[model samples]
Target: MLYYRQHFLHISNEGFIEIPRYIQTYLPHHLRVLIGQLQVSSHQLEIERGLSRGVPREERWCPICHTEVESEEHFVIGCPSYLDLRAEFQIEESLQLCMTMGDQWHLGRFLRATYERRERSLQLTHQTRVSTEQTITEFFQRVELHQRGPSIGLTLHQAAAQRARRRSRMVGYRRPQLYQEDISRINTTYNCMMEQRRTTTP
Candidate 1:
């Protein structure tokens, strides 16, 4: 369990979960941190910061978008900064898409582009951070879905069918001890009748 957490749940200084090293190389360090935070929701987003600092609930609008309340979903799927990138990749901004889509190679490209566009120009916006989380979440979820191939119900049905077939074969089976006892009784009766016939004939 410790090993699993180290490899998969490892947290960075920015409070983002660490991704695999192979995929990590494809993304900039900051982008990787953003992805990690998105996956686990541990980042210092405006909403969280507000809660920590006792800032009013109404003041949580995205620092960048300034239109919608800063949230993970809005940042990833609705923020305007990523609209062009999302459109270019034909990526729909939906949780359903995140959880069910099988292909996510285009997402990598989108992330790289987004990262480059805002790398040094501005402070990372709540939308961007949330978007990064959503993208990573989608990628991981796709991988998980691929790994879990068939449904649990199908596997259970197969196992139950096997057990039923085995039980059906046993229905007509008899114990060897019962057959042995019957044979022994018939032999003893025949012996006694032979002795009686010999005694009477003599």
Candidate 2:
């Protein structure tokens, strides 16, 4: 209900929800997705998405500003990262007011550019993290090889292989006891059947 309200802004009891004309008619698929994401709160900004990620309000502050919550309002107008773009678009304090003044195209353009900028930042952050983790893993691997020798490394490899085999079995494996009427009876029957063979073999 909250998502619907946010997407529609507001709706009357009898009103039908409609897609915005620009998004439906003129905008390209990518731009449509971008604009539609904001309308539906699927833009991956820290405000709503952060809530699902268990990010506290304090930590959900705008990465660009390092102050104030990173809401849609803050992204469109408050953050200084797009100051030049905002100035070029002649956008003042209130983005809603500016859109009401009929600069909707400017808003879309600003958002498209800003979203691309944000994506670049996110990609760079991910790359940095991956690189750091790789470096750390390599460092530890080298340390292990130097200090623990080849035998320990071989043991680690065997352990990893055993873990993989266990995981593979877990995919379709079911305990035999689950389908059996009585586990104790089944065990006793197997033991009785093997008793003569066991004695002869011994």
Estimated TM-score for each candidate: 0.38, 0.57
- Estimate, for each residue in 42-105, the C-alpha lDDT of model 1 and write its tens digit: 5555666676788886888766668887655666577797788878877655733542351345
Number of the top-ranking candidate, with TM-score as the measure: 2
Compose the digit string of candidate 2's lDDT tens values, residues 1-202. 3653653564547796554544545555676676567766787789887899998966788766677889877888888887888888777587446434435566677778898888888788899988886665465354555575443133344656888887445676786644466877888899988997898895
lDDT measured at residue 198 in model 2 versus the true structure, 0 to 100 = 90
lDDT top scorer: 2
Per-residue lDDT, model 2, residue 96, is 48
Least accurate 10 contiguous residues by lDDT in model 1: 95-104
lDDT of each: 0.60, 0.69
* Model 1 ranges with Cα > 4 A deviation: 1-33, 99-102, 115-202
In candidate 2, how many Å is residue 75 off? Answer: 0.4
Pairs with backbone N, CA or C atoms under 3 Å apart (clashes), candidate 1 = 38-133, 76-131
